[model samples]
Target: MVYIIIHLHGRYFIMKQGLFHCEIGMADKLAMVVFSGTVDRLMPVGIIASGAVAMGLDVEVFLTFWGLNSFRKESLTSNTKMSRDYEDMAPMMMQLMKTKNVPSWFDTLKKAKEIGNVRIHACAMTYDLMNMKKEDLADIVDDVMAVGEFVDIAKDAKFTLFI
Candidate 1:
């Protein structure tokens, strides 16, 4: 039989299975590198992080370049433009989302954080290059981190995505 023990919040629980021993703890981690700033591209990043968090995965988002710009407090709420390749469809898509009562991508990410472990990091280099201060970023950002530091965190993630 397999035996398993899990400790949480100072409590311990045990389980038995067939011929194996296991220790259960934190779920897998998911890392995402968000580079695109367009609404359409940014939408998927939030949605995917929501899904991962819902499935018990910890999510870390590294925002750089245009992605970092999109997270600026002033831009987060007012921006609605999509990728240039689909610029013609932006209006239609925005209308459809409004008609369907879809939540904004930033709101979605915020909700995910409320329900699970979701960390958002802004690239230090991008922050400096753009002459932006940490206060310029949305409150959702957990910290400003160097690329090397982020890479170290992401290197062992169960899965990594570039969006």
Candidate 2:
């Protein structure tokens, strides 16, 4: 089989005229396991994903449980929940962010997707447990994936972080 190497942005992706597209070569991956629903934890997911993509790495974010909840279309914009460790400070911090004109976590992640190869996968198990359909999730979510499938992708990541 013959393949052509295309450099889009910073990553090199292999493509063939009549075959499925897959990434190969110098393109590293940054995998993230986002398990937290709170804004405090979610913020880093977006920031880190953005940074990784800017540096020419593919980002695979697996959203499970609470993290998946935060991606629901209904709550994506309205969420104000904070981590338990800073529960009491949530109000003040939220207000501060608003005053400082800081973008919401969802917005940050959305921008990252626009700028680079960032794939956001919703957990299929979590979706079933939460009784959610594909439409229930925000548009930024690429598709539903099983943990095993996600593991297959994450196993070879240059580095993986749980947030």
Regions of candidate 2 where Cα sits further than 4 Å from its true position: 1-24
lDDT assessment of candidate 2:
0.91
lDDT of 1 at 116: 85
Instruction: Kindly report which residue stretches of model 1 are placed more than 4 angstroms away from their true locations once superposed.
Output: 1-25
**Global lDDT of each candidate:** 0.88, 0.91
Q: List model 2 lDDT by residue over 1-163, tens digit each.
A: 7888887754568889866487676578999999999999999998998999899889999999999999999998789999888999999999999999999999999999999899999999999998999998999899999999999999979999998
Residue 5 local lDDT, model 2? 81
Which candidate comes out best when scored by TM-score? Answer: 2
For each of the candidates, give the backbone clash count.
4, 0
- Model 1: per-residue Cα lDDT over 1-163, one tens digit each: 5566766532345667642234454568899999999999989988999999899888989999999999999999899989999999999999999999999999998999898889899999999999999799999899999999999989868899999
